[model samples]
Target: MSITLFRTLEMLRHVPREPRKITTSELRDRLAAANFDVTLRTIQRDLQKLSTVFPLISDERDHVFGWSWSRDAQVETLPGMDAATAITFAMAEEYLRDMLPSGVLELLAPHFDQARRVLDATDNGLNTWKRKVRVLPRSQPLIAPDVDPEIAQSVYDALLNDRRLKAVYRPRGREPREYDLSPQGLAFRDAVTYLVASHRDYDNVLMFALHRFLHADVTDEPARHLPGFDFDEWVQRGGFDADRHGEAIQLVAQFDMAVGDHLHETPIADDQHLARTDDDRLELIANVKDTHQLRWWLRGFGPDVEVIEPAEIRDWLIEGARQQISRYADASSGR
Candidate 1:
């Protein structure tokens, strides 16, 4: 067949596969939007022709006929879709949407159909579960970093195949720098995927943002095997925590009645103790890691909370508040 005729037949298959019903005009519009350049009459005629063998149907009772697959049609003819795999794809389509490469999702499109059919048949509203559940960040929400398809695929390929990679990594506004490394592990946290990898010449493990990879390629060399690498331990050691600064210290703070009321449900730590004072304030003490995240948390409570110790942290907060107050004062004076 000619390429044009082949593409026409391809477009014919897509018309009825939309998630919802479509009129011939709507189908033509979809084709146009997809850069198919087909006419509405052509779509109607193709639908009429394909209806003989396909499970295609049209609502003739309506003033304007709308087309879709037959309600009772089984998607079994499409591909391999066992009940288990179908449900798995249904869940993966949502949960792994941000985790996996887009190419993988496209490769699993047939299974998504299987998932859709199984979900629709079950009728227990499992298909709509995406709307019912939400995974929110503990901090203020922010837009997730955009990941490139080919770059992500290459990263996964290297990590999964236990191969080394040459990557051009750019940090913040810095210029891109090239390096050769072995990917140790992959982690997803707060809408960002990180690559825990080590330098080719050293034992140091550094994390790379998947989105920040300008280029990456799987190399022939095998990845360096680190015998005692543990992702959880690395995380607990604040490998991924940007706020980890200074040594761990005993964090002591005082909270007003309002802040104390809030902390009743969310104590600073498991071993934290709150003692009431004469002025109805509560003093809290906990042995915690001296991280900026803790400082930021206390500062967020504004006047309701006060940092008492270590003296260094309290001094840091005092300096920060002074800077903020001066900045505001300057802004008010039209600086």
Candidate 2:
């Protein structure tokens, strides 16, 4: 394919599926707007080539055109692998990055290779492209830094198979303990990942952070799904307010106006609502799961922020500040 043809198809990728119809003149207008400088004839030839190789459906009489994908069409269309599968894997890689386990990537590597080969056969620049399209910085990972890959794989496999697991866990500041658990769900919270399960020892639902486990062993014991323990309800009750369960609580914090712009641009919450107070303070509302998590987040702002609501939360912040002040004074006194 010519560079012009490749560029045109790439542009079409951005167009929505429902509004798949585009007239020749509309296509030309779009190309011209994009500074492509291509003629109508070139666009027609490009569309024809795309239709033959891919799934570009058109109604000539109605002057309407759109793109759709079929399972068989996807399998047969790729110069080697279909566009859909290739795009899916590429997009997944872009989003998941280090969040995915190495074992999962190994399983996906072959499929990704097939897609790359197909793109290479097209002789498009995609084959030789080494552009840095996306960049994700290395920060402290959400999960524990030293979680054993083998143990992670075992838990993941158990989750996939709906199997029960027996494990020895050593909670922070606690002794090692063993339990037989029915794994109900898994979640990543406050930079930690946890397995929510029904514990035989407690006879209640409990969350065990994956990183805290000393050992995780899958058992042939029959999996038991808990009754009246709706995952969604349990999550919400735990103050997570998440869609399925453990819903996060919405928290609002007011900050001194000096750093309002900085806070607005670099939000501390995944979802934040910002407002300017009459007293020149910036109020930010965000969803958080636990008071401890919120306190830690607020501590990052030092004196610039103040907890605005949830009286208990505000008190906790005050107490944390007092503790820090005491520690500073004691350190100064060399005690």
Candidate 3:
């Protein structure tokens, strides 16, 4: 292709769908970055000419003129949206809409729209795959807490650009405080979104609930990385666990045979061994991290499971049961 064709095509790609737009200056800079090195006046002239043939519009209402593809434009690419790519984008829209940053999702709006159109138009059996499959959460779903859109965008930008954040954070049951945070990563657990970050000059990292930020602003200061911090490794070691004890423990528990049957297919740990005892009870032995999650899982089994080896865990369960019994006894007396 000629230089003109390439520049025009690159410029078109930078033009966002209506409501989101690119100024002539922004287009010129983007083109320069892409090695097109075009002038702002040239971009303006090209846009004016292209508007006659393509569904392009200029927003003259703004002080700085902005250009965009019309909201209902039917512009097609050289390589059209195929069935496979269409379905992948469709699935991303369905599953990842909540997890992705709002700004990123907005940028993908056009592709998502085209994906839906392609899937709806296809007569092949492949389009039916979306209807046949479903992803169910392992735990009961709760409504996600609402994070302020602008704050979320700021947090995302800081993390993406390796910059610091000035934030007013309110911890549960505590007064709101201001902090300069170095955002390391974002974690989405169940319905909550957390920003894994370190407070100014603090070596230790903490997870801040995104919804608890009263205010947030990205700063120009460069974010400092902890000497040996790896977000993935920290998460794997149960960093998010409320009662992490820093070491793995040998978990030995006994369960009623019928209730523990699922362990045969879905063991808690790779080293987990489940066997039937003479009394027809299920005995399980495994090496696993002793985290609050483990305790919660065991407690969820109630009378069906018993912690055998770890005296501390066994005592914990017994104390919990005793407290429950006492509470029930008092309630019965009142009745």
Per-model TM-score on C-alpha atoms: 0.64, 0.55, 0.79
Q: Quote the lDDT for 245 in model 1.
A: 34
Score each candidate by Cα lDDT. Answer: 0.74, 0.64, 0.86
> Which candidate has the top score in TM-score?
3
Off by over 4 Å in 2: 1-131, 135-143, 173-175, 201-203, 212-217, 239-252, 258-275, 284-290, 332-335
**Which is better, 1 or 3, measured by TM-score?**
3
Q: What's the TM for model 1?
A: 0.64
Candidate 2: residue 320 Cα off by (Å): 2.1
Please give the TM-score that candidate 3 achieves against the real structure.
0.79
Cα lDDT tens digits, model 3, 1-335, are 89999999999988867755779998888888899887888888999999999999999996978998887786476799999999998888877666654544665677888888898999998789788877676666666677776677689879998999999999999999999999999998766789999999999998899889999988879998998999889888888984564468998999999989999999999989988988889999999988887898899899999899788889999999999999999999999
Better-scoring candidate (lDDT), 2 or 3: 3
Clashes of 3: 0
Ranking by TM-score: 3, 1, 2
Clashing pairs in 1: none
Per-residue alpha-carbon lDDT of model 2 for 23-142, expressed as tens digits?
666667666766778777777777777778666666545534443332123323335466555655665665554565443444345566666656556555554443435555433545
Question: What's model 1's lDDT at 56?
Answer: 81
Per residue, candidate 1 scores C-alpha lDDT tens digits across 81-195 of: 6555666677777766665545445445656776777767665656576467665435775445777656776788789889999999998789999989899888876567889
